[model samples]
Target: MYTSQQPAIAVDGQNRIHIVWSSYLPIGNALYNIFYRMRNSNGLWGPIETLSVFPNSYHNYNPRVAIDSEGNVHVVWEAYLANEYYPHIAHRVKTNRGWSEVVVLQSSYRRENPSCAVDKFNNLQVVVTTNEIGPSYDIVRFVRTPEGNWEGPDTVVHFNTGSRYFPEIVATPDGNLHLFRRDFGHYTNYCYRIYYKRYKILNYVILE
Candidate 1:
């Protein structure tokens, strides 16, 4: 059997809903992979499709889904590949034609729990947690332009003695990006507290 976890959903302007999640299988070279499905405006659900490529003894989880202004579907997830010990954030986009190839964003540090959103101008924005520092993880953001150019893995939130993780991102129609995350061991002695930050977009630049 298989187990599913951390499902995310997004709706397009046409009212079609897309959903993605990670599925785990006990016996296979591919232990975990991302899967997706869609519900049409008529409320009929489409067949489930596998989103992660290669499988290849890698595990993927925490898939986040978003729909851009042009009706393209975007998914980002935490992937642990077969040949890599460190985790990476992987992204894929589906347009009217088909799904694009998987884009793996690997960094020197461990990254995971990606949250993604599409801005008013159709730029894809993503946020993930990085554990490069000693004590805890910090949240970082990445922006993918409509023309497929990528920018920024900038650290948006940091903690010296604790960890901030499991970030969630939202893009408003007014060109504002709102970020929410959970913190541990910082304010209340091992308790997780909710933290929020916002960014404004001007000419494709994210401003504090």
Candidate 2:
């Protein structure tokens, strides 16, 4: 029996379906970690694989995955830091060899609700919500360069009155990035509207 939480999916160049999700253990320290599995295009499901290597007592959830042009899998998830209350973004890559160690991506404040995509150039892009300034959460982005290095905590969108959450991204062949998020003005308001924006992939610089 397979049970999981916060499941995400992506497709590789070979059309193999890849999935990542969180799973909790019943015994010992009551630990939770991210698990990964894939289904071949030929109609076969592979073995289950645990991605996160965090120690016991920590939780890893809200996973998102993007498969690059080279068939390498990039995954990002949110987890509470040890001895800390705030949540941090964790990332890992699944190469030909196997899943790499989970790496914490730096941010000015705690991050929550993350999404990711791979551009035509095979560069990985991620978006998340952070309450860096005050009670309001802003949409921020992280990008991976051609050299396999990461850059930015770039501000994708910001609002003075409300908090932003649950960001998603999509990259097009023409080098365009489309970002979407949920905004809230106050706790009393549901908003119920989807906020959206589009920008050039090379530079997220606002036209203003």
Candidate 3:
């Protein structure tokens, strides 16, 4: 039975499709752990793998997956770690042997609702919301370089310090990153407002 919801699928250059989602398994009196799954080339799905290993019971949701040119799988989601809530971004590369271990890309502050994509150079770019410090809101980006290392800390996209949620990232064919987010300020009377920004990878400028 499928326990996890919000499944996102992506295919790499070699026609390798990667599927990722968050699953909750009952432990005892209302306890569950978020798990992930994948389908290999032979059209057979591997066993369900647990993503979070927290002791205390916590909820994990909103999982998104993206694959790079080299068949590296990037997964991002909202997970409850310890006593805090934050967005977690992880990557697994397909090697000649098997799938590598999941590597965390971001693990600081209270980030939620993450989205990711890979640029033309096969670099992974992730976007998420953070509200750990104060009442302000911010969108952060994490890029995985070709050297198999994550680029420093998160780079802020917008510094509104307002309410931002439901972020979506997509790398355009022109090598530019397109980010879509919800701005609550514009829709004070309503629920939320949709905001779009195009970021140039080379220049690192957000365009209109």
Candidate 4:
């Protein structure tokens, strides 16, 4: 009845487990849908809830999620619109009320490999890579402020032509941000290496 992949998990302050994954073949369509399930603090597992609200047609892929201090679950993924030429970052959140509607964070850029982290103050950071029609070998980052406005489309890193990929980020209790990503020689016989970078917020700027 269902097939799934790209599972992502996070645990909130209450130790409740949240799981998000992508599945396909709901009714013979070749596209995929993102689903979520959760085990509450009381140890009860909820039913499978579909996250991708494409209603008619679309493909949501490569999901990643993180939990904030308030036990809010935030998820980011790439949704390939039915007739659009590129994919964009899709986001959703689950609070005490319920899951919010899937929001398209960016549709102009062809982004993928979405990852997210929440700071001590619950500022959400989402990092993604552009694989088409963007800078060569670059990673882009977006931060949602505490007041609920999205702050950036920052090109956090660049390695020149097909080397930047798989960016993952996390925020510490002290508000410092850490990122890890892989760089491969996109056009040569070279080594694929994983690297880390640290950034701190100082006077309204991210000092790397």
**With candidate 1 superimposed using the best TM-score fit, by how many Å does residue 176's alpha carbon deviate from the native?**
0.9
Per-residue CA lDDT of model 1 for 1-208, tens digit only, reads: 6788888898888898999988885335668888999999999999999888655538888999998878889999998878778789888999989999888887778998899998888889998989865567888888899999888787788768788888999999999999999988747578888988888988567689
lDDT of 2 by residue, 1-208 (tens): 5457888999877889999988775323436677788999998999987776655337677899998887898999887655667777888898889877777875547898889998877888888888875657788888876566888787888767777889999988888888888777764276656878888755534332
Best by TM-score: 1
lDDT of each: 0.86, 0.78, 0.65, 0.78
lDDT (C-alpha) at residue 173 in model 4: 79
Q: How close is candidate 1 to the true structure, as a TM-score?
A: 0.92
Better of 1 and 2 by TM-score: 1
The 10-residue segment with the lowest total lDDT in model 4: 24-33
For 1-208, candidate 4 gives per-residue lDDT tens digits of: 6678999998887778989998884532327888889898899999988778753437888888898777778888888877676778888888889987777865565788988998766788888888543555578788776555787777788755657788989888786889999887754456788879998954235787
* Error at 76, model 3, angstroms: 2.6
**Candidate 2: lDDT of 15?**
84
Pairs of residues clashing in candidate 1: none
Say which candidate scores most in lDDT.
Answer: 1
Residue by residue across 54-146, what tens digits does model 3's lDDT show?
A: 443366667777776666566666655445456454455554566656565545666777788878777867777776534667677767666
What shift in Å separates residue 39 of candidate 1 from its native position after superposition? Answer: 0.9
Measure candidate 2: CA RMSD.
Answer: 2.8
